[model samples]
Target chain A: MNFAFTEDQMAFRDAVRTLLEKECPPEVVRARWEGKPTEVWASLSDMGVVGMTAPEDAGGLGMDELDLVLVLEECGRAALPEPIVEHAAVVIPALREGGGKTAQRWLPMLAAGEAVATAGLGEAPLVPDADRAALLLDDHDGCLHAVEMSACELTPLDSIDRGRPLFAAAWYAEKDTKVEADFELAFDRAALGASAQLLGLADRMISMTVEHSKEREQFGRAIGSFQAVQHRLADALLRLEFARPVVYRAAYAVARPGECAPADRSLRVSMAKAYAGDAATDAARAALQIHGAIGYSWEFDLHLFMKRAWSLAAAYGDGSFHRRRVGDWLQQREDSDA
Target chain B: MDLTYSAPEAAFRAEARAWLDANVGPFRDASSNTADGFAKLREWDRLLFDARLSAVSWPEEYGGRGASLWEWLIFEEEYWAAAAPQRNSQNGIFLLAPTLFEFGTNEQRGRILPKMASGEEVWAQGWSEPNAGSDLAGLRSRAERVVEDGRGGWRLFGQKTWCSRGAFCDRLFGLFRSDPTAERHRGLTYLMVDLRAEGVEVRPVQVLDGEEGFAEVFFDGAFVPDQDVIGEPNDGWAVAMATASSERGLTLRSPGRFLATADRLVELWRARGDRSDPAVADSVVRAWMDAQAYQLFTQQAVSVLMAGEDKKMGAEASLNKVWWSELDLSIHEAALGLLGDEAQLDSDWLRGFEFALAGPIYAGTNEIQRNVIAQRLLGLPRG
Candidate 1:
């Protein structure tokens, strides 16, 4: 069957691309390498992008996973230093799916762009102030612990990417503030969110490399004219394309939740994460290679992308971890068949 | 955006299924476990063709029933569901028939379509040359114009490799360089040459499966009349591309085909009493899911085209090609893994393994598909 995007979806994509082009132009992205302005985040929140997947009642856009994925891809393409994935993909969904009144009270604020939210999954040292939100939710002992009025020191990590500022926070749970019945669902949502971000990062890397190859020339021709470079770029492109549907499929599974078999969903998510992780890293490395000396320079903006690629890839679980999960899932299926 | 089939489409699916059961034989029995067991499956294609059920979407003037696109898809799904016999005239019915319909002269269609539907004239391709494989445009197959008895025609002289079923096919469709000086991809002309013509030779190349599915054809001044040309002189490149595109566009291998093989693999695992191993069962389920995904993807593509949308190919096709190719290899690899040391020796499983190895190399390499997405779809500057 035809895989062409529907007219509405295509229009939506163009709208998102145009918005990012105008608001988060390359110069703005470059300027906000260290951290974006509060007003810029506020504007995105006003535009309903931050709460794209949140329920309409919760002041969110209530877009499907596919819609959110489209926006995330544009965000990646522009290399915009915004927490769209953190707010839209993770925090908003985590709060709406029965994170309780504590979550409800803050989700709308997060959706309205009045407040900022960042997920602290797999981040070591569990810094409390890493997130600037009024509330921080963490899963421990099979219960989600929601803390209010966090007061802890936040130290920004010396990140390779000036765009994404990493923070180390000191957290105090205060009390056993258990909130959602299904913490695993939240975890899956977070994984899907991270996977979406990885998809965007990977896509951007390929775009950046393609642009560099066209403009960068050696020996009277663009390096892209050379087959060696072409083959590598082609390989990177293939990896990105292959990983794309997996990410969307995983997001689809997460959105539907119980509609899919657990093992099937888990296997797909693992495959998406594993494949996207590897592809993003590879594409970034290839981008660097194609860019050559210019890519390695600090003055050039390529390293900013390379850093984001590395950080996002390893943010959740790495490729090997997800690969083994996929393998195990396959093993289970084989046994069932036998 | 929707993936569900319409109500009428679903009802048609049920009707087609019932019809298939009443007409065709039962599914291939797993007990027929011999090496050539696939050949023993009943000829369901003939039954369908005889009933005017084959190629349902082709025009009514041809052998097809002139059904809607959705109806044709419904027919395909039901036929596969019933485990119908593989089309013995796939080369003629799928590849050549479509090409003929698109570009053939009125006389050509009237002459070839009926025989192809009835399975009387099997057709094979003769495009690949000895020195030209992937770079098909660089082929040196020469067809010089000649005047014989004051009438003009072409005398073909060349060697073609990878001509599948050429040894037994009734006709061969090929590209020949009509203008030697007209540069690559420009001087070629498409011709439908009789395989039994004088000065034509065929030599079969035995594959790893111990079957001769491919052959090399040599033509030494074999004459083809001007009427035999499918399109304009020295315009074979477009025809070739159309043929190749059709070949790629045809739905990926039917799920029923893989389901049959997967079912066999499951039975083998059971016979060995290794069903207790969860790993083995898991692999079976994964393979089943992959086959299902491919089936769904094909259905989606067909649905979109049936809805009257402009159906350009999708990246998913490439993904499907790569995934199915690897799935074949992986299933065999898993089969070998399950068989353990028994897999090392020559067995039916080993033959299956060898056959699956060629999946990636044929019908355009997966590498080429990747390059296509990178350069074309992704807007990556061509290198």
Candidate 2:
């Protein structure tokens, strides 16, 4: 019943955090809004985290979702402007599961950070970073197909989160390679990765507000001294603390699918995604309200993370989407048993 | 990161399950839905105490199985699943027992714990007063030093209100300003007093649920022997703080009870909920998932407590307090929403909602908890 992470996992997460601090600070995130290159993508690939989920057979780290979830959190904490989640969490794993020639072609490049990719999985529209991707994977009725960038007609969509540039892609279906492995698990991985990132964003938002409250003074004292500001941030912290472990448990369940109870692994994944989304969004709202006009401005770094929370809150599966499914899951399971 | 229990833990769970299955049905049927079921409830407590299942985490010397935190958590899960009964001795067993173990003299342990374990003495807290609900340090309850015929003791004076179950409790424990000259949070002493004593009056008060679960306890020169004093005479604040975490943290409201409520809500949804009503379905699922989140959080928290030199929960407990109390309310709210018009009726869900209303208000209020989290946990200024 021990739920503590191994020291190695802890150290690895710390190292990624250190690297994100150095390479993908808020300025770098700001630079993304100015058409600057996401050099952090190269830094992350050099750190071998971009392909952390690719199998050992593909010269990758062969890491578990448990191992990669923390790294994704670091990416989210940085608000790193890249497709690390879609590339590593979804596309590479989907390719590896395909176990075909397409997997052989993309595995080495993606694992070594020589190339980047993006996906539209679980029937979610708007392939992120599709314009720059060398390869694309799209989900159709729970089946994954590897698509080519050159063949797809791309239409760009502006995001409130500038780091994430989305595009509507129409690819040539006949030419794309269809992966024959399990895509349901790939969807869970996608949700897990996004959820872990949302957690990181949530933590960052509360911390920024907490630090701001300590320094920003009004009414003859630190604003944090007032119960109004303190209580709002405290409420944010409560949501994050409770949401975090559920995400970690989802990571654990994803890494060891057989160990999942009730043998319905998707429910855990959805729980993490839904809870993280709500927590992060709640934090974003609190961050904005607590920071007053400062957090509302484009100049403030708080908006960057807050916008990321708002965007990701609806991405993958929003609270409404996942909640309804889990609701149906609960009712259907009972019907089956009865 | 392993979530599966070991053989011994599983065996403990199985033993607990078997015992609950064998006893709980008769216990519930005999005790529930009666005019006055206090004796039946005490009988159930005795039944549990006799099996050493009343406080599984307590030491074997104190009538427990001496279970680990994991085993205890499993026991709680099983207990809530099958034996879900209101604990008559909860205040003593959950809230005070931890503090008692921390600061009690060996004699205190020998004298007090056995009675608490055996349900011979039900305990209630005497912290809040008419003047000091959230501002507990503002309490003016006094316990003056006394000596008569070569015997030393303390004479309690002043009032303590909102004493949960004080209407029926056999004993009460709280803090008193032993030194009148000392200001707030100083010169205080923690003491245990017998409710049956001559100088104490327990006036039953009707709570929001209209039950006599609360009492206004007035102390008028109630004599408590020196043996009843916990910790140093004027250092009661520190001692009480050590156990306040127990009241606000995982000890008092474990994930087991919420998870049980969540499962019941799902059942209610199956019986009455509509998928077309996405909002209500969403509420049910979110409540269930929140319960899972709480359970996972407890696992992480218990593991943290298992390590570290300062094993007691600090300000992080405020986070736990806020989460579970609200989660309890929400779960019951979802059930009531499923019930619709019938929610106003005298049902268990209505009763649960009323009880949960007290959660955010009691155990130092969620407002106080938030301040503690901000200042202590987040290192914000206490201006």
Candidate of highest TM-score? 2
Q: Give the runs in model 1 whose Cα sits over 4 Å from its true position.
A: A1-6, A25-39, A121-129, A149-162, A165-176, A257-267, A323-338, B8-44, B51-87, B144-155, B221-227, B250-327, B365-383
lDDT of 1 by residue, B1-383 (tens): 44345687677677777878896665333111222332332144455667777667677777787876557656766676565655656667767776787789899999888777765666778888889877788899899999899877899998998886565567889899999999898999999888888978878786666667777899998889888898899999998777766666644354455655665565565567366566666665555445544554555566566667654355545655666677777667777878888887987678778868988887678777666655666565655
What is candidate 1's lDDT per residue for A134-240, written digit by digit as tens? 55556566666555535544677776566766666556654545566466555555566667667777777777788877778889888776767877877776567
Candidate 1 global CA lDDT score: 0.68
Tens digits of per-residue lDDT for model 2 on B163-227?
A: 88788788999999999898788899999999999899989888776777788999999999999
Residue A153 displacement (Å), model 1: 7.2
Residue B210's lDDT in candidate 2: 74
| TM-score of chain B as predicted in candidate 2 | 0.97
